[model samples]
Target chain A: MSTDLLTEDQREALQELVNIGMGQAGASIAQVLDEFVKLSIPRISSVAAANLSQEIVRLVGDADVSAIRQAFTTEFRGEAIVIYPEQSMAGLHEVMGYDADTKENKGEILLDIGNILVGACVGGIANLLGMLSAFSAPTLIADQTPAYRLLKPEHIQARVALLVEVYFVLEERDFRCHLIILMPETDILALGQALDRFVDGI
Target chain B: MPLSILVADDSSIARKMLIKALPAHWDITVAQAADGNQALAACRQGNVDVMFLDLTMPDLDGYGVLQAHRDEDLNGLVIVVSADIQEQAQVRVRELGAIAFIQKPVDAGKIERVLKEYGIQL
Candidate 1:
């Protein structure tokens, strides 16, 4: 049984991989918004499943928010989630070319954006890792409670993930989201092979 | 043959994407490999000038392939084109004799810059 989810090197390499995925995700969202959307420098950390919610809460902050979680399967299976701060919804709508007070279903639009970001990110990761993976439709996790809990079912097998904090910014408005990618079942050899490439000088 | 270039990646989509990013004035024999092992094999066949490689692959991932290249002192220049964009990966690939690192969602500008850095015209 493996004790650690990732070595420093593996985390670094995975971070780099996630960076590209996040970049693609951010780019997709920017395209839809038709504005200069800035993406923050992404970070990857390994926290146990037990502590994942705490980490999520810390990153998510205490704000009214909405979330979209999507489960994906490839050679390894896991989920990709994006949580949005509620205050930014109006700004997003405006940036997306909608009138500020338009009666359009904001939740539906949120899900659509999540779907595009998650799909592009997952596709980029799969394309990089050389594995075929498919992501399920995004599911809303409500606006009142912390959305990370939606991912922590009793049967969840992913022990760790490369946590990417993705923020979309346009001028004065900032929309924050978290892209959590869970690592699936893998033999020790597979894990080691995946990480060994970046161990140099580490 | 003007110059042979090996495009190595696990994803057919990515490989095609890299190929499509090549400039119009470029004239080279573009070889394709689906995994690191095949990438190494391409090097063994010789006369390859540049390799656009991805780090994570099924059999013999990029690091292993790069190590093999180092051990055998392969002549082809390795240009890592991957989604792994960490500085550590970039440094490691450079140490392994890769000449450049281009992150994925690769564009023509990046490709052109790396090609110019290596003195490969067009």
Candidate 2:
């Protein structure tokens, strides 16, 4: 269970750290859109590799969504997945200041947004926790696919996933996307220890 | 009299970090609220002289609390401490009546500097 992986205090500390990281991510997106972005309180849990698809369906409710994945390594190793509902692209297009002619380039735009958000957020958390990390360029994992069908068979090879979910919304324009950070169980112990050190220092 | 300080954030760790970042030499009484509703309740009871608030929370975020503060004419100086460091968020908080804004992963130096700059006497 997620609770067993980290003590109550460690989990709380990790959640707070994730909050700071997501805030940086929100700020970066806000800058790009030149608007205020609403941020959600981040939620963390551990899911078995086999349950990954079920978990995605649970969070996103089987909607047709566009998803991107960026892998990060070093002390923190895992993938940062950004999922956006298909309908949000129009809003994103308008808010991003892209004209009709450039609408076809929306995929590129999504990848860019994914890159900025994942980089700023994951990077912010790493810095706060004193972990060094490097990120690969983001790739499109799924385009307007059912949430449950988003992940490939090979992606579920990990024994367990440390799932962190945070959402960013541009309320007025009705655009929103979610970021899920998944670290394999192999790194969970290290993360738990880091959280402990962080709490102790505080 | 010791200043009554309230740290309002959904995250317990964030509250702790903010409390730790407070000036060690200052004489103050601290209160904590895990959400903005609790923050407003504390203000209504005249318990908070200065508030360190987070913008994102489970219910009634910092902006909601600030709006209510203005609506109720509540007494307390509000300082927003949040990870949402966008210029718009900052401007919105200022317009909503916050005295200052501090970004998260807050440090002692930043807290002290903001306090000093705002003429908040310890």
Candidate 3:
């Protein structure tokens, strides 16, 4: 699975698919928070699995990273990530209504938001693709490391990765964050035919 | 007169939603299964006429449940209610002899589509 493997048509199809997935995810998040959430332009690209973390780091730029990684299974197994700046964790905690005294509350808040955001994102993507995917519980890690290194795929034995990155902005608050999903190269290839079917039908 | 159906999914939210969305005239006797193995077992018992199965669950998952439905030569129409809506899911559901594959967060239109699949006019 080369980086340039997706053709113009496939690229367009995938872009639309990501757009739908993100929009749905945003809607669900909005419902959960009772606020309006906007999704930015989602960028979709591919890389070797070994380069996954590096590619993610490049896309995410330099930020103190707070991430939750969740793995999903089905015919195609991969990881879904909700990545945010360490700077914004407190704001996110506020938005999620977690004003607690215990230091452990922060970790709990991080995992809760991550789980909601990542699960909805993955579930929404699966819904649009007509794919069956089940998610594991989300794990939170607030590390000032590179995005890729912090949330790389381990369970999937694959050669390439398809990464979709999008920004979620909350209208009622100054909270905006990144949501990334990594699909195995083979999974994307399998989805390629599904995309073709959708495109053909349309 | 009514349909004998099995509704199986690990998510209580999902199962409850489907139960609430049932057509008023269905007059249905519903059996519920919280996971894949229970779904498979219920379908194998040969009591239900149709099963609304979820693909992702704790024990068996949807594929295994469908396989069991086939292995026992069971008689029932399967409608897959899943969040995984990829084309492969659709093809696989059809391959496993499902009458329809409906996406999650099921709404009235989706319910109508399933009904249409079952030869209901409206």
Best by DockQ: 2
Model 3, A17-134: lDDT tens digits are 5654655566567766777665665677777777777776776666668677788876567777777766555556566676763457766765776777666666665666677778
Off by over 4 Å in 1: A1-3, A98-104, A146-162, A184-192, A195-202, B1-122
Better of 1 and 2 by TM-score: 2
> In model 3, what lDDT does residue A61 have?
68
lDDT of 3 by residue, B12-43 (tens): 54576677777766667889998988887787
Sorted on TM-score, best first, the list reads 2, 1, 3
Task: Name the candidate that leads on lDDT.
Answer: 2
Clashes of each: 0, 0, 8
Residues A101-195, candidate 1: write the lDDT tens digits.
Answer: 44346667778888887787767766676777788878776654544554464535656444556555654566656666656536323544644
Q: Is candidate 2 or candidate 3 better by lDDT?
A: 2
Q: Is candidate 1 or candidate 3 better by DockQ?
A: 1
The docking category that best describes candidate 2 is high
Clashing pairs in 2: none
- The TM-score values for the models, in the order shown, are 0.58, 0.93, 0.56
Query: What is model 3's native contact fraction?
Result: 0.00
Instruction: Kindly list the per-residue Cα lDDT of model 1 for residues B26-77, writing each as its tens digit.
Output: 8888999989888998899887888888876767888898899999999888
